[model samples]
Target: MSVISEEHVRGGSVFKDISADDDDWQPTEIESLCMNCYKNGTTRLLLTKIPFFKEIILSSFSCANCGWTNTEIQSAGRIQEQGVCYTLKVKTKEDLNREVVKADSATTRIPELDFEIPAFTQKGSLSTIEGLLDRAVAGLEQDQVVRRATHPEVAVKIEEFIQKLRKLKEVENEFTLVIEDPSGNSFVENPVAPQKDEALTVAFFKRTVQQDIQLGIKADDDLDEEPAGNDLETMRNEVLTFNTNCPECNAPASTNMKLVQIPHFKEVIIMATNCDSCGHRTNEVKSGGATEALGTKITLHITDPSDMTRDLLKSETCAVIIPELEFELGMAALGGKFTTLEGLLKDIKDLTVSKNPFICGDSSTADRIQKLREFGEKIDKIIVGELDVHVILDDPAGNSYLQNVYAPEPDPEMTVEKYARSFQQNEELGLNDMKTENYEEKNNVPAVPGGTE
Candidate 1:
């Protein structure tokens, strides 16, 4: 199921001297101003490729005047097709010698201590485990001089933390170090090389919206919302589009939208995405109208196999219930969708099993994963109409619908009901604060200082 291709693994040797040029084995040099001392300094930049890894730039800046220096690494290759995470167990003092290639966008964490090095807090580095900890120590100590002068208590605690961090290098106890790089450009050394290292595990994941933006994979404003409250007559023919990251790979993609009408229902916007980068196709539906004055609850009895074909509109605000399975899904768990009964069941199953983040990958979470698989099996029974169940649709927005196969005739097994929403439901739907006919007089609202008319 993982779409990422494995990069070449290096072993036996520590590293292939990634900063060395093909012929000169030296970085290109340039003189530059040193920010530390405002003195002339030398900056060396290298363009080299790591065997089995992508091309990258390694830079070293040094100022003789203040003895200030900095080193960093940057990717010259395109972003990886997937995000990558590395987890390594440090059980012995020798484990501290493991080499690490950390990208600037990578986040490092030690769950044992509940400590983290957030992404972009420091420069990327090609260093060993021991060196990484040394950097962490240096970073912690950097601000202590100033902190001690202004605030002693906070500085004292930081000193304690720094001491604890230094002890990690000693490896007195077993611990795990995690590095998550959304760019998929980071690496942790595998001592066994071609052979797998038992202490290190790598995982690939889809990047989140924020991660995509931070990596320049997608613009921050690309995922635009459709204009609100547009009447069908005005925009139904227009196919609006906005950029979005592919849910499968985080590559840039476009989502196209148009107003669509379902029989006997109000207009809704249907958006479809076909990601060229990953060949991932998807669709979403959103109700185009405003919330109703009353909320609706629809109950349908699954009595026959034919019920599988019943069309259902699950609004974003809808909650699903299955009495037979004793399952109740909260709102926003599944996004707004318009699909058949069978499709809805599959979506629910996928949400619980395949797409669940906690789906088993390790021994610690196998029990939870099994329970989710069992839940999916129950859904399968319901989909095949093998189980007697009542499906309930509760939408406080009153925008959800289930097809009445009986048409004009009342469906003997289905019941439709509407009721006044509770105070909490109104608040959740923002109806409690909605002001439609408020003459500024009712609330005595204040006007802006530079108001017009």
Candidate 2:
């Protein structure tokens, strides 16, 4: 029996070079029982280091007789000490080129698509922002819920959302990309951003007592410590609790309604219902504020990596445009999110990469592939600080915001303009153009004498 030392494993000397020929290879003495056939099988462990992240162990097992094969990836180092959330705006073609490292425990969501790629369902991957959205689109296409939708409208909506996601990759659409990891192992890289610029907002918050226990952290006397904040106080004071019938089992269920305030956005009324009898749970969000009237357009020039750090808040009613890139993102192309410029670029790149077939799949034309490659290279150059671009946000509802950290003192590279809405734009806002009085007039009905007594 051979003893495997912790140092040997951590130092990554347990595996042979993968590039060597099979005949020239000297197999490590590692052996394990085949998971499928219960026969002794050879195991190979490889160590690979990822830039800006940690080393990982890629282990493979093969049953020589039954031909069973399996591969697994495990982190070679300690678990992350804190959780992380990455919010990215997908506003331009360059934004789509950002690199993303998603751990197995990370959850990704594109609210506009009404799509969420939950943790544990996907293996850890190091891909571009565009690759991530492509995976989400693929998942939606194969989802049992979408495939077996009973209602035609539900199916149609799902298909429409998928199309929107497809459009998001083109330079013509915008969306918000968010990733949350409780383990703090995931990352969305902003390589072009300056070192001093906090391009990525790293918000640190204490994990729940339950989460700490699960992670094997020793608990102290402060386990019962209360969270202090206006938000908590509001939650405690405004929680409206009642009993309701569960939709799943028709059993009596408890419901709680509260007004929750999200930072950088208006308050939202959240209603949550849970049934203890049938294990049913549901939650809904509603707007808790009035809408704005005037339209707004925010323009910012991206010249240096530091510019990518600027915060952006794009409302659902906003349309994003990059005139130089000849791309425009219409309203509701993506849901609202608070993220940096670099994050947004990553999302667009990921979406565009995902829709390559639609973009240039007809003929095996070299010109088409070359053009796509050139376009991708241009985006890559922008991400690495070699190129500059302009980002514009046009919101008819005046709800979008582009953070100017150096306020009072204007940023020379940014411009904000407000304008009156046009006739069509005002109509879209559900304003005075609804034409309620024209129904009878259009149908050639004369005014009913004295109101149709």
How far off is residue 274 in model 2, in Å? 49
Taking all chains together, each candidate's TM-score versus the true structure is 0.53, 0.39
What are the lDDT scores of the predictions, listed in order? 0.78, 0.66
- Candidate 1, 1-453: lDDT as tens digits: 111112212222112354324343445688999999999999988655553234677788999899999888887666765687889999998788776888899999999888999998888888888888889988889889999999999999999998989988878888999999998888776544222357887665668889999988789798956867866576777888899777544568999999988887788888899988658888777898988888999999999989999988999788888876667665555668888989888888876667543343321155555666777878888878788899999998999999999888899999999999999788766677777774565878875578657
lDDT of 1 at 58: 77
Q: Which lDDT value does model 2 have at 161? A: 82
Which prediction has the highest lDDT against the true structure?
1
Residues 1-453, model 2: lDDT tens digits: 234456655643443334434443333447889978899997886554443344566667888989988765555544554566787777777777777778777788888766788767887776778888787787767764745556666767778888888888995866788888776767775533212113343332345665555445546543575856557566746787978777444457888888756565566566788888658766644445555657888999888888777766666567777676665655653445456777666655544443343233322257545655566666677777788788899988887777776776788889989899998777656676456666888879877767765
Q: After superposition, how far is residue 328 of candidate 1 from its true place, in Å?
A: 2.1
Flag regions of model 1 displaced more than 4 Å.
1-234, 237-245, 437-439, 442-453
What TM-score number comes out for model 1?
0.53
